[model samples]
Target: MLKKLGQFTLSILVVSLYSNITSFANNKPLTEAEFKATKLPYSVMAYSNKYAHEYGLDASKAIKLPKGLEAIKLTLSKSFSKGYGPYASKWDYNCTAELYVDKSLNLYWPGDHAKVDKVDDRGLQKSQISTAQLEKKGKYWVPGPYASMLYDAYDKTVKADLASVKLSFFGCGYIPSRYTAAKDGLAIWLEKKGGYNYAVIGQGEREISSKDFYVFKLPQNLVNSYLPYARMAAN
Candidate 1:
């Protein structure tokens, strides 16, 4: 009985010691003072602060953010068909914010939509065209589960970080859909806040046919869909 008890105590001691060592080594716990001192981009810090204060997430509960942005992506989405346009049966609107680690990280917005149910036996809006018909329009359009991710015809590029030329995306004439303010892909848009700039290597249209990201024409109403994860270049 004595031996067994002694062995048990020894085991417990070893385990406790090991655990303590592991904890200390595994996680270099940051002090509260150190945490506060962490430096971030001016724009990112400001944006993140607002998001955390207004919404409940850690500054990044929403998706669809600005490109080259380093804070939480706060967004709101309301369809035009609510009481005015169409698709009034089952409607949804969302408010979201997506967070990122830092300025170096790039975000990819995941898009997978729903079925376009036809109102009558004859059809729904614009009559759902088969993939074959849609494909011929351009190489950018893919058969998406929901609304297809927008793409551009011919590629384009720009300097977002320029001191004079502010990164531009989205306006009235270039609606993503006829419904949207941009006719190009959503993932390609960017804006240069303050003086900092973001450089684009490739775009969302296709597999590196060209190195271009679209400048989306964002309107006041559809700004909710613009969620960009900070993409950092890999070292």
Candidate 2:
């Protein structure tokens, strides 16, 4: 009986250790003092201080987004830049701050060179697509699950169309790839049927094909059908 009790206690300890490791992997909070001790990007620290005072080092809680970014639902993670490069950044760019928008996106803001100029060499001073543009199109921000579903469909496609056509499939798959501020969702494909190149929208029961792709638009209700998939993908 005593050996069984010891085994049970050991099992509990293992479970507790696993939980703590998982929490850390998910960006659990650090103590305020521990957070302040690290070298952080000026813009991230300043912005957090200004707008999200309650979220200092505690990323598990939701951080309130500013007005321009309110249209989309995104979880923001506050962390210093890993570095600058094609796949990842170099250590010299460590002064840069990054906002991890869940697992799908990373929004970066320029750091104040005057503040951390000594270590801040390349802080991505010029972005091709600025945050202002993102804000302007925030209504189209695909929720996590939807994004994952789209990615999965594209990843696991048994057949694909021309690159210029903007579509892929697995025997008539209905994965939604894009949504618009106009309250429309779209997935497009191109195929030669009856010796005519036809552009197709949607698949299976709710399918449409036409020469002019612009004419094919999904209604709000149909577009909303993917929300469950999107929600599921996010979790």
lDDT of 1 by residue, 1-235 (tens): 3222111101000111111112121223344554234332101111323333433333332323344332322222333333646645443333222222222323121122111122122111111111111122244433221122121110111112111111111222222233322223233222212211122234333321111222221222222222111101000
Residue-pair clashes, model 2: 8
- Cα lDDT tens digits, model 2, 1-235, are 3222111101000111211111222223345554344332211111122222222222232233332121111111133456546657422211111111121222221232212213232221111111111211232321211211100111111112101111112111223332223133332211122322211233222222222111112222222332222222222
For model 2, what is the alpha-carbon lDDT of residue 166?
Answer: 11
Off by over 4 Å in 2: 1-182, 187-192, 195-216
Q: How does each model score on lDDT?
A: 0.22, 0.21
Q: Give each model a TM-score.
A: 0.20, 0.17
Minimum summed lDDT over a 10-residue window in model 2 is located at 6-15
